[model samples]
Target: MTGYLVRRVGQMGLTLFLIITLTFFLVEAQPGDYASFYVLNPDLPPDVKEKIRAAFGLDKPLWQQYLIHLKNTFTGNFGVSFGHFPRPVMDVLAERIPRTLVLFLTATAASFYLGFFLGKAIAWRRGGLFEYVATISGATLFTAFTPAFALMMIWIFAFRLDWFPLWGNSCIGGLALDILKHMVLPVATLTLISFAGTMLLTRNSMLETIREDYVMAARAKGLPERQVRDRHAARNAMLPVVTSLVYSLIFAIDGSVIIEGVFSWPGTGMTLLSAVRSEDLPLVMGAMLFIGCCRCWLT
Candidate 1:
């Protein structure tokens, strides 16, 4: 395991390096320089703009800028934010990463576990109420619906009707309850968007596994139904789910941006999104490379 981890980490590092190189060139390839933002602004004087560009080494040769950027990056300096005053990109990101993480980690854990157990139950029962309802409720909707609309439906039906809280964060006051409160809408949203795909995948895969020769052999040997299902069928059925879930986690990390944007939650995803929009090269590249390395890890 130790050797495996070491190899994976090294591979992740190489993947990240390549991401940095690729993004650096791509960002540079976009129209105009970072200084152009100021130069085109009606309010800024040309002389001050030149000085700002010079000070930030924006006026330097591209190769020199790349070398300097890499050196600073190696030393943990992600560079100054063009938008924020007296703030480093890393610091800005660090402050928000936790809150965004809270939203995603909460939503994902809820989505995956609930989907897994419910899916397994539905698979076993096949034609039951849970199966029918889960198939219907989960099948037609997705994250495509407006978040607020869905949340409002849940709030009016579930919370206003006494099913759950309408708005709250579980991160403070009382750790568990606060989390439950804040988690209500976002978790529900994620779960709703997530349930159908997972359920369908698990149900289909599990049905296939139960019919396999090994499961039949176990049954012939008089293993209990539960034992046959869990030991033989469950493990095999879940292998793909486990791998897919890991890939989903990587997507969660990057995809959190949109959900974060919707919820006004802070996380690396939104920060990266902002960086891309602002054309803050260092921050954009840092985020892209970080996300890419994470994706490589999942793969």
Candidate 2:
């Protein structure tokens, strides 16, 4: 297991390097530099633009910049954010990442386990009305567009009913209850979508497991129906569901930009969106690379 883990870590490092290199060049190739965005003032002198470029090392050759970026990345410095002036990219992420993690982990954990057990229960009673209704609901949710669904939720819960706060992460140093109140809409949006996928996969896996000879033999032994279902069928069916749960948790670390945007949740996803809009290449690249690492490591 140690040797396998070593190999996997090595592969993750190599893949991360390629991702950073490719992302850097692709972002560089985009039209207009970050300096241009700041050059909007008609009276801003050409020398001022040069100063801005020089300060951020954009005036250097692309090769030199790439090398410096690579070194800094290795040393845990993600460079300064061009959009936010001199603020370090890592500093910006530090404040936001924890919030994203809290929200994402909470939503994913709740959805994953709930959906898994719900799926198992439904699978055990496959032909009942409850099973049919749940199956249809899960299928519908899986097919729904994430951003649109989030918007619908915001409109209904926040705008129309005003049950939850419309946006933001709540007041700083606020009570835990206040923070949770603010989280409801965004968490619910992610939960429902994630639940659909988990439930369907779990149900399918359970269905397949129950048909296996081992399950029949367990039943023939006169074991209780619950034991046959839980110990024999559900145990084997959990393999695939667990895999899905892990991937979902890892990717959820990236957060949902659209949902965050709609709800104005100040998390990493919202930060990434702002960085992209302002053409902050360093910040954008940093955020993307971090998210990519999370995904690659888990997969």
Candidate 3:
């Protein structure tokens, strides 16, 4: 396992380096560089614009620029952000990363466990009314588009009932409770979206496991239903679910970019979107490369 992990980490690093290189060039290939913004400013003289370009190293060759980016990335300096100019890219990411992780990780965990138990029960009671209702609900949720679902939730909970705040991370100078209150809707939205898939997968896996030879043998020996299901069947069924859960965790780390944007929650997802819109290559490349590396490592 140790050797396997080391090899995977090395592969992940190489993959990340390639991703960084590819994304950098792609962004650079965009119609205009950051200096174009400075060029369009009427107040800045031609000499001042030239100086700005030189200072930003826009005057450097593409190969030289790439080399500088590589060196800075390895050294934990992601360069200055064009979007939040003068603020280092690393610093901007640092603030948003934690917020996104907290929100997404929590939602992922809640969805997984809740779905697991609910699915297990539904599968066990397959022909019952409870199972039918749960299966239908899960199916509905699975088919629902995330953004539309989030909007519907916002309309009902935030606008109509006024149960939760419409957006933002927290109120100014608010306590922990205030932050939790603010997060409820976004977290719920993410959880419900994730839960549907987990529930369906778990139900199918459990159904197959319960019909296996050992489960029948256990039942033949008159073992308790719960033990036969939990110890014998569910354990074996978990292999696929475990695999799915790992990928879900990785996605949680990268975050739900559109969901965060809709909720007005400050997170890496929103920051990355902002960076891309403003053509902040360093920040955009850094964020995308980081997420890609994380996904590679997890896989």
Best by TM-score: 3
Residue runs of model 3 more than 4 Å from their true location after superposition: 1-7, 36-40, 169-173, 212-224, 253-255
Separately for all candidates shown, the number of backbone clashes (residues 3 or more apart, or on different chains) is 6, 0, 0
Order candidates by lDDT, high to low.
Answer: 2, 3, 1
Model 3: pairs clashing at backbone N, Cα or C within 3 Å: none
Error of model 2, residue 205, in angstroms: 2.5
Taking the tens digit of each residue's C-alpha lDDT, what string does model 2 give over 1-299? 99998999899889989988988888889987767767778898889988987887889999998898799888998877879546988888888778778888889988998798889999989899988888888778867888889889988998899898877756346788888888888888888877878888999999899999999999999999999998999999999898888889875765567767777787778888888888887788888887777777777
lDDT by residue for model 1 (71-121), tens: 876788887666532377677767766766677677777777776777777
TM-score for all models, in order of appearance? 0.74, 0.87, 0.88
Task: Give model 2's TM-score versus the native structure.
Answer: 0.87
Worst 10 residues of 3 by lDDT: 167-176
Identify the runs in model 2 with alpha carbons over 4 angstroms from their true place: 1-6, 34-45, 84-86, 211-224
Q: Which stretches of candidate 1 lie over 4 Å from their true place?
A: 1-14, 29-48, 127-132, 142-180, 212-232, 274-282
Q: Give the clashing residue pairs of candidate 1, or none.
A: 158-163, 168-182, 169-178, 169-182, 170-178, 170-179
The weakest ten consecutive residues by lDDT in model 2 span 165-174
